[model samples]
Target: MGKEFSSVPMYTESAEVTKSFDDDGRIKRTGTLLTASSHIITAVIGSGVLSLAWAIAQLGWVVGPAVLMAFSFITYYTSTLLADSYRCPGPVQGTRNYTYMDVVRSHLGGVKVQLCRLAQYGNLVGVTIGYTITASISMEAIKKSNCYHKHGHDAHCSEPAYPFMIIFAAIQIVLCQIPNFHELSWLSIVAAIMSFAYSSIGFGLSVAKVAGGGNNVRTTLTGTTVGVDLSGSDKVWRTFQAIGNIAFAYAYSTVLIEIQDTLKSKPSENKVMKKASFIGVTTTTIFYMLCGCVGYAAFGNDAPGNFLTGFGFYEPFWLIDFANIGIAVHLIGAYQVFAQPIFAFVEKSCQKRWPESKFINAEYMPFMGSHGFNMFRLVWRTIYVVVTAVLAMIFPFFNDILGLIGAASFYPLTVYFPIEMHIAQQKIPKYSFNWMWLKILSWSCLVVSLVAAAGSIQGLAVDVKTYKPFK
Candidate 1:
């Protein structure tokens, strides 16, 4: 929220800092608690937040909020563990770990490093695809909102999502030029603002719906009525999918070390990051509670997968239009936030493999001053964006995609690795209370991840029956 308004932090420009490099010889760590918190918020409250009402609708009144809280605590706790691992021997003085995989390699080496790469980068790629799908959904929702404004809510106002996906991809193609993770704090701040704008609008709209009332919605303690709203198996699958949705909503731990690496070294990075994580997670939990609970109350079992874009509040057409626009813009920044690590990895790998190849190693376009363009980077990143956009177009089932990403990411990145690393790093005795409980938590989350995945696969299978790809 503190975006440095009219006055840029004097330290923002490199000329002012006494030192140009930290112990790692990279750019001096200038990020504050506020900046880190902004990044965390931008990462955590992403496109996945749009589906919470649907998730809550699946879990019902009691379980939905409860599940949200449970995930929140788990995310915050695991994030602290991850933050501590950003350094090797100890929290404060140990050598820095530059990426999530580095942290894994340092703490628990060998095969776990490969596992970290698979989970972290895989989740980042999935998040990019999910963001593309979400951005397109919002763009189509904007067009639909305008149509509803001109005609009526009941008008045949369907729009094909593919074109919007293309438009979103093109925008990302340009923003992807920003190069890497270091320059993204401003973007993160902007994205966080957009997140607030749309989420608040959704909450306000939902509250209005509940207040200016007729008996329009039906809610129960457990969730959707089994026989009436769904079959027994459907009830099971959707509930699991909804749990996955909640898990996705709380996902940012995978990037905690990278974000922490940005912090100044004086105050230990781990300490600052824990505070940032707490602030970010707590802030999103409040918004998530308000938006998800009120949205569910407004539409009950019929709640749309997207609060603003699902045509729930058509009368405030202009407001809905603005909210959807905010979504598209926020995702433009978020796509890069999740994608930059992937970009750095790929570029670094390619450069290493072909050290003599000019295409990979040489820099072009010096107009941006110190940071010149690289041909391979430009081409590969563009292709990455295009591929994700194409995948979004092929399968635009929003809830299912989000559920699958969440289930795939939440346990491995958010829970399992952090806990494992913490245990290994601290050298906790084999059967101590802390170690035993951490093991239990990890196993429990793994089971949750499995079921959530099954539920997502089930949903996708069902959706695929009638959904023609690229149609």
Candidate 2:
């Protein structure tokens, strides 16, 4: 037999080895790559996309896609940079690995923290208000459509719309009152599916309509007609307004840290999270592009609230009804996603004051000896619902109020917060100040947000003039 020497064990005290393997002995926990396509879809598919078609149509075909692309690029780059800087866990967690106030406190000191908190409070409130209003509009649309079909005219439809608003508001408030936010994941999934279905079908039909040489009548362009002219001061205003819209689209940076922390493997979690961001953003952009193009093509002048106007003339009332249902469901899901944190914050504040109340539990009643439902949660939820309902009813136009809040809150939350946090963490040197591009972009977002907010407020005031009593 050939002499076989036993292999000597190689030992080096200073050398360390970490071995990881998958089921097949390949590297374990390798980062999963999310396609850019999926990310674009998720990032752009929110409530704002519903209105993009109308916004784009106002700019005309030549300017619409160009402006949207610019906004999309800004949104994507800002989101990616913020996600990288904070290494946020993700949206699943209530608080990001770092809260906005904490980041402000660290980077800019205590004074900035107070300011950041104020901004955060405003941002959250604005989001809540926006979601509520959007949901309310969907409710109004459904009620109005139903009433019109039943009575054959716009008359006799107004009372039902307001009551339906209250009913929908109450339903949303109840859903949000649930303590476990994660349970709402199913709703998000369902919303995502509905969005995909609706968008895809609408996209297909729109393209088919175009191909069929459908007569596209250009509505009479006049200053008297709201959102008809794509020229003059309106064009400039729209350009600025797009900033707020874009900012709102990317304002959820705080949730990213929570998502990152929740990942099973810390070492490769950033990679995976980045991959997801890429997928979400890319996919969202494509959907938005399609919506913008198809919507404008379909409805040149009479675009309904947003994309809906594009489909208003399409027959088969059931299809429109189904689309409306999808919108309602999607809005509900979006509302809950933002509402959970606010609810938790309110709940915690209440518990601190009234430790004796039994309403803190899931039973919907006060603790064993308590006389009524947790008065705190009840009051809080009711107030939130009432205020939002009143505002929505007052400003029934879809994008006006929603756009304002979105613009006002987008900059501080998305751009400023991340930069503050990264600086706080010392991931970037404080005095070095090398990142000129980010500083410029941040300031650009700030300016745009402010202008958009002003415009939205003005738009709301203008819309209020058109409000009429219930018929």
Candidate 3:
């Protein structure tokens, strides 16, 4: 997360260094296909997936899974487009763009690059906020003694999200200091494992609940009452917000380049990335399907905003603790992975804007460099973590925030930009059938994502009117 592959001087003197598939010798390109897939899975599946039950709960059985799968397909296609879009038109490996904003600047010009920067930062910050909320909530669940039973029985608990959010932010203040995504490879793997563990445990709890004659399974489109009239504005709005939630759960496009950069150029980087996307999305989709379906079947309309929080069983309370702990752990890694790009962009900008600044060092800082202790790194990352923590404290609504982030960014980052960049880079004809279809597809995505974004705003407005901070 700290290193900049772009700044690595391309070694044209050595053919191997400039090997189309190799890193300009600056990056070792040590990752294999499996590692690449793991990173993709780690990037894609996060605490957000825990909310899928509630998300699909709004769309019902039919539409919910359909939308989830649709997003999986959409993201996979766009992410590959992004990977393929990384290289420039010529055979010169030196001309490649290594970051998302660089891709935009190369293909679409400065205006779009600026816009891309906005969306990328917005999405990254939004991810920090969302992960902060999840980690805090998970820790809170662990702290509440017998809180699992209380959660299931509608009893009150003393554990609040604020203190734990502060605690998690403290941890992020440490981890965010790591500079690059490649450096967090071990953490990413652990995050992926934790993601799977929580997912399996969640699904098991749901199955156990249903098997124990727990008649609480009550499905509903509005998420509260069964068969609510679709004509009502409130119900329709809720459904769209659900769409946002699903999209948010599936969003990993923002970090696609960072993930792809981890892989070696051998065996084709785009091919490896495509395989990684397929593996990650397929695995996540299966887990999501099981967890979402089983969790809904267990709690029906009564499922918690977080699917894991819904299961308050006393028989195996340790499982809840383990699952929640996994969530907290995974999110710590996730926060770093998503935060790296923004950190790099800002630091590079600082270097350019103040070339003569005392903090600007001419010597290259390798991954895990001693210079990581510098004032600039410490200050900016601390500020980033603190600001995100504050936001989480003020608005701790898990599902709603996901909707807002997804709505605001899903179209621009995940859908619109990738396809647009592909069309531009490939120079697809303006009036050709391929161009027409892609135009239709991209515009449709724009419209859908905008609608979802609106729904998120509406939900947030309502939350502002009624939400109790620290409650």
Compared with the true structure, model 2 gives a TM-score of 0.75
Candidate 2, which ten residues in sequence have the lowest lDDT sum? Answer: 1-10
> What lDDT score is found at residue 15 in candidate 1?
45
Q: Which stretches of candidate 2 lie over 4 Å from their true place?
A: 1-44, 84-99, 102-109, 143-160, 217-231, 249-251, 254-269, 309-311, 352-379, 426-433, 468-471
**Residue 132 alpha-carbon offset, candidate 1, angstroms:** 0.2
lDDT of 2: 0.57
Clashes of each: 0, 32, 7
Task: Write candidate 2's Cα lDDT for 323-405 as tens digits.
Answer: 66776677666666566556765676666676656555323333443222344566677788778777666656667755776
Give lDDT tens digits, candidate 1, residues 89-117. 89888888889998999999998899889
When 1 and 3 are scored with lDDT, the better candidate is: 1
Q: Report the C-alpha lDDT of model 3 over 124-177, residue by residue, as the tens digit.
A: 999889989988988887766366454654556666678899889998898877
| Model 3 stretches with alpha carbons more than 4 Å out | 1-25, 90-94, 145-155, 220-231, 311-315, 362-372, 468-471
How do all models score by TM-score?
A: 0.95, 0.75, 0.90
